[model samples]
Target chain A: MSPIASNDGMRPWRLLRAALCVFVAVCLLSPLVVVLIISFSSAPFLQFPPPGLSLRWYMLLFSTPAWMNSLLVSVELLVPSSILATIMGTAAAYALVRGRVPGAPFIMACLMLPIVVPGMITAAALFGVYRGLGLNGTLTGLIIGHTVLNLPYVVATVASALRVQDARLELAAATLGAPPWATFRRITLPLVLPAVLSSLLIAMILSFDELIVSLFVSSARVRPVAVQMWSNLMGDFDPTIAAIASVCFLFAFLVLLADLALRAGRSLRLT
Target chain B: MRPIDRRIWLLLPATLLLTVAFLGPVGWLLARAFTFPQPGFQNFELLWQRPVYLRVMGNTLLISAIVTPIVVLLGFPVAHMMAHGSARLRRWLVFLVLVPFWTSLLVRSFATAILLQRHGVINSFLIGFGFIDEPLPLLYNLTGLLAGCVQVLLPFVIFPLYSAMARIDPALMKAAATLGAPPLRAFVRVYLPLTLPGVMTGATLVFISTLGYYIIPALLGGARQQMVAQLIQDQIATFGNWGVAGALSLVLLLATGVLLALLQLTVGLKEIAR
Candidate 1:
């Protein structure tokens, strides 16, 4: 590292740099912090530095069927889609990494199309196709849509991990009289398991947070929390949404914290 | 032929799933865009001839253009700090970045609504402090839309830029300094040029994502300020005009394709997966 670029050197510049960093960080984080505070407000409306602390909104959120049902719907879709995406993604990653699949690059690009294309386009297209297939507004449709949306992340993560892994182990196992399935199960799968799990978790998060596609594909019978939140924001302004935001914030935080813990543990094992 | 390659079989399930579930729908939409409503490029003609359709497209591009530079300007310093800081500081900075990065986009948009509304935090503070006699119009406008977009895209810019900057040797800067160049000159001449790839990558990613963004623009940008996504949704949801919607989607798909191709050339295909 350059001494001039070091934090210890150039006092005024360092101070300015430190201030800008803190300012930007605070600016980025302020909204979430404000939402957390507002969720606790006893007042009926969104009041900042809220009137007083209470779990009234949270209680209200749980008591309301629409909000609670939406939450349940989101979880239902999140779990199935995450699992489906993970399985497909892990398989695709394996093929791309080790399989003698022709046109691996083209296949990888196609897999990533969902990530690159605008989501509204996907949602609209699915809306039309599902209308014909009688799948629109069904939970299965949402799951399929979400699984496609999430497949890329899982594939990328697992594929990157597989790229760095030593293939010699799989070769050795096969040479030592292990069948293909046995070699994969005992050697290849075990090594990439952590990344596969990470991809699953990340896929779950993506499904949970998805809004635009869900807005298009979901019906009143199968609305996700994000769709519910969108309708709620448009129709009314209330702290109940704040309460819901806080619940989501907490859910996302816990999942991310778990992901971090998993990563840290894996790194420690490697070291 | 002891055993067929398992890899080929492994790819089959995903390929089947994507084809049936994912590509099938998109392909159907593309087909409908051509044939729907007794159509023969009428939808495309509508997009080309209509003033409102053109306006939304222009608005989407304008907002992205405005947001990209601001995000880069704000992201550069933080990324610089993260790249060059001590390990402990780097850890803290990464946490600060990742928390927002991982936070739900819906939650972030809602927070922006709460913070930028007429009586929201910023306006309320300004009024209370007597800085303004009346609340300034912030929400449901371009300002609110930009705020939401920038926050969402900032981390995208920072991470790529930081990665690129980190790869550069500090010794080059030190050498420039030793050769009697001033600090600013060294940065502008040596350090800046080296980090150009990162800046290009971050800027392009932010722009492309912004162009495709739906939720923030839909929620924070109110009915008055319609964007391309909103227009497409309106075509389908309100008008039930699938042909027009499909046509609009094709336009967006084409734009995204071109930009992504550019990204591939500049940042490499591997950088995109990350």
Candidate 2:
């Protein structure tokens, strides 16, 4: 570690490095930024550099029936499904990490099965599972499907964080007359809160952008924005889609940014 | 807590979740694939009945094999550059690597369509450069599909390698150099072997992901270029054959699971992720 120095405090080198970092970050984030730029373009066609910017496209989004319906569908599913996934995923994370479970690693792998499993399979599998239960094309089915898909994030990330946590802390509290529930509520909950919040944010973004599963299982009730965008992209290149994508991109971006900000705030508070 | 009591009781829910929600469904899906469309291995019949299905599967495997190597080739240098760079620079590079990650997959696919369309940017640029008389056939074809998928999947391979290369001990490289190995040789012999786990991780990650990628192929692939995922989709949605759809889905699931198990055996997850 000592082998490296901060450029021996070389100001010019430091400045160059800072510039390089900024350039790289911009390049990496360019796609999202480009979408944002194109989304606000006032023209009726997609172009790199816009002649002018207006809220007309966004206005189009609000006034249009199809666009509004898709947005509504996205929200309706994301809100409740995120909640369910958080609870179930968090419980599963706790069991996998803290519990004296047999074959913890295998369980962790199973929890992460969705991420590793192709979405096509999950789509197909759910098509089978959801149909057998009479939940296919219904909100309940979509919830079950989304929950299973997004649960991996909450479990994997939170469990990794929990694995580093001290087991003795809760035991100490218990010895001092704190009840099991109180110990969890006071200590474990707060510590894992950051992971939980970020997980929720990421999961919501995932369910919102998810296309394959929705393509299979969903119908008019929850035909998400992604489906609309996919259809438009396939059949025709509509400028309104660019606009809708821009808004969806912005909405998802804010959620992720807020998640990062939230994590930062927690670390700051802790420090 | 007693070991057996705590372990068994606590794991009860996890086991049930795995068995019922994940594995049970996945296994049932695979069984459906074999016995689908009136039972007795009719789904596997696609392997022989439809050469197009086999061709598509081959195309899927071939494209991934192509993409994986290129991803590794391109990703390694980038990862190396970021790993050895100053922390300030590396952090920014990392942020750059992650930026496309947060964007919508569908949006990227659309952007790819716009980029690769016959009269789109690439053709426009080539025409401007006076490279060709006419626009090249790009999007809605295999060339465009591969291009779009590689762009999205590049990050998967890169991120894992970046993390792995970052944690590597610089001293080992220095040690190799001290023993008279040149920097390039030292990197090839010393660094590359250590990073094999990352390579495997990245490859498996991309292979498994590219296997199920729907948006990229749907938005970019031509009529003849559709992958298994799309085939399954069409079978279920357009053709209205749940049994066939169920069957094909199982094929992909089993293929992916077997590959994943192979990855674990080859790379050993503990070394890379942990």
Candidate 3:
């Protein structure tokens, strides 16, 4: 393709475009960087160009019983919810792609409803329903809500992976005297394992980061870290909040590195 | 009887879970908008008669309207650079965008508060450089709300626009130049129209997302900047008013649905999946 002819007259427009891109990039990244820096500050309150840096805030975060309990609750919630979502979502995706299920598109859309609807609406609805069933303010309620919210991600990712793989391999194994389960275990699962693992990590992150649904269903004793952060934000501007936020950022960074390593040479697609 | 596809059994677990835990609850809540505390239209009437409810709804719409264009304008250049830039630049841009996208909303909002508070980094820098005598009231106001929103929602617009721009044929631009069209004129006429699908899809996503925001407004916004989502939460938590909460939810869902329908009509929803 012939490049748009570069000339002296186009210099100003090019400069303006480049500047705008740089500004947007800084705006996108600066908040996270600032948080990372302030998490190390020794000051009790938020301060810029911090006088001295120390790990006091992080130490406080770990020592506080409230923060520790919320951390435990978040782990307890995300583990079961993410595992359940991944398993069910993988099966559904495989069935839609290969099983020739009737009305697959409609089913897919139905499954995506939790995400398409606003989180606040879902939270209120779940709260109202749980009131009758006496599931409100319980760990089980939070886990169930997070699973529904995260299911769509797993389904979307695995479905894309399955669509890209060669279905003929499974068919070939079947024709070679292998049963359906054997062909699936030997051929299909190995090929899509990376995608399955990636989606599991994504589901876990989504659950850990979830706030609205957890806020509605969880009690003081069953709160996630995000809800805890919200309550802390409502009261004060302590640097301890910044410390916990940095811990969250670090968790996300590690997950990103793992995801990139898992799909090394493949083009990244965020679902 | 004909044998059914055994593979269809795989769909059972997910379907059962969604139907029982998700659809049943959300559907029951929406149904309460009309039927709760005795079946009648009183809830909708209450929303109409009370000026506060109507005003908050109006404010939510106004905030979303303001956010939509700013996100699109800021997102356009970054998306363009990513679509046409060198491989190294594209990779860096993608990394920058995804890192924030994956980070928790709580973390980002907290970070934004740190940077925008009166004695925070930005204000300190301005004062240290002798730009102003008094610190600006940046946090807990409209400016703070907009900053929080535009940062989080930038990726929503950028990715869709990048996908649209990458599909454009460069030859068309060369032809427009050869035919004596100026660069600006060529972009306005030939390029912008082609990117309409992407722009519309991204703008719609941002608008709907802004309408449902609870965390950002709670943290960064002042009393005057209250949105509908917070109102819904307050009703349920403070008053134990499921009827009013359900009614507010209905209004929010209707706004989202109407916009989604319009987007589907203009550009199929599949473009968003792309």
Candidate 4:
């Protein structure tokens, strides 16, 4: 809250800023908007001037067994991987923050290194090792890969939340005849709960959108949506790809929206 | 320190999982690339002599160098504007930057293909406007690949730089201005130097990600412009050339490590993106 609101109007610089902002936003949103419209198209093919609108394309998506199976697989992988990644990340953050573990900085770096390294390289490297160990084409392998990639985000987000925490709050609880477990259960965990939720949602998104690693490590058994989309693209640029993509967009939006709502509610509780 | 707390013991599971899942894969692959059965420098030597391999490496570096600096140069003005703009306006700009953030890179690349192809919206628009007799070479080439890469990497550079720029206090700039330094000079002497850490971060993020990308080149670039990642991918998936694939993989891994380490230790992007 600045005292000065800067509420003046009709400035040249402001107009220029508006134009640039509008252009970037339009560029970002228009592709998905176009794709969403075409998903409801009546044309037999991915025709640009789509003949008409209907839910037939979506119905077609639902009817296909392979598409249905892939969607199910994506959900199965996302939920478990997100949960596991969150747990591991929170535990690691707690350990590193609370204890003077030797080589803590280096350990933190190693835990979050996948975020910096290119996914393609990581995918290739993982493919070789899994194939060597006979872990390729299994749901177990997909979970392992997805968890590794998502863990870093969880660590970073939860760490930030934990770092902002007040130590005296825990000390205050301890002074009030509270046991260590009670203090942690009643105070420490609650403070970082929103961050935990945020990390989990982000993990789910990462696992959902992942394509390159799935392409390498997975086969027919556990194909994620992104992997299935690649086969559809290469097989002949199937228009159902767009239909499914729209479904995915909506799906991701809802999940993120839900997370934001949860965050707002949680903060209300804290206040 | 106070013998490990019970809560702190939770770290073992995470450490063990990372060891098996992440570091295990990476370390094992690097080692396997060298000594699956026996060790030798022969695998790496081939990486140097193969013309295609050399050309692809050059292409990788060239693309990274070209695309990153250009994005930095262009992104600075926009990020700077956002930093000083009204709060409401800044929020809208951030949303604009992040809308594509939610979408997968695969989806964005596909859209870029549709937008830039010969019969795509862009070429068709220009041809329809009588700018050229023929549809200009827009898609399935070097130029198209560059265009898509720029769009993808722009946000990565912008976010970090914008974060840094937005943190600069306005009072410092006002002081410089009041001391008879023109606005341009004040920005050049004060703001520019202060934001070098951000510039370094943006450049590292862009350069590293660009070096390891395969999709943009595979979809948009012609055969003449194949990058190192594409070459390695083709070796394994297309040709099933295991020995060459291993060699190429090692070459890429070592090259990126050495380059990134050099950049990290010397130029110091640690304070920025890391």
TM-score-better candidate, 1 vs 4: 1
CA lDDT of each prediction against the hidden true structure: 0.87, 0.75, 0.91, 0.77
Task: List, residue by residue over A1-271, the lDDT tens digit for candidate 3.
Answer: 3445465556787798899999998888899998888889988888877779999999999999999999999999999999999999999999988887878999998998888899999999999999989999998899889989999999998998898888999989999999999998999998888899999999999999999999899998888999999899889888898899999999998998898777863444323
Shift in Å, residue B238, candidate 3: 0.9
Return the TM-score for each candidate structure: 0.96, 0.89, 0.97, 0.91
Give the TM-score of chain B in candidate 1. 0.95
Q: Alpha-carbon error at A211 in model 3, in Å?
A: 0.5
Q: How displaced is residue A142 in candidate 4, in Å?
A: 0.5
**lDDT per residue, candidate 3, B47-100, as tens digits?**
999998999999999999999999999999899989989999998998889999
Better of 1 and 2 by lDDT: 1
> Candidate 2 — which residues are off by over 4 angstroms?
A1-30, A265-271, B1-24
Minimal lDDT window, size 10, model 1 chain B: B1-10
Query: Comparing to the true complex, what docking class would candidate 3 get?
Result: medium
Residue A168 miss distance in model 1 (angstroms): 0.7
lDDT of 2 by residue, B26-55 (tens): 778777665656768766776668887788
Candidate 1 Cα misplacement greater than 4 A, ranges = A1-13, B1-4, B271-274
Candidate 2: what lDDT? 0.75
Give a tens-digit lDDT track for model 1, residues B1-274: 2344757888887888889878988887777778889859898888889899998999888998999999998899899999998999899898899888888999999998999988899999999999999999988888999999999898998998898889888789888888988787888999998888788888988998988888888878866568888888889889999888888878888887888788778778675444
Docking class of 1: medium
- How high a TM-score does candidate 2 get? 0.89
Chain B TM, every candidate: 0.95, 0.88, 0.97, 0.91
Report the number of the highest-lDDT candidate: 3
Each candidate's fnat: 0.66, 0.40, 0.75, 0.39
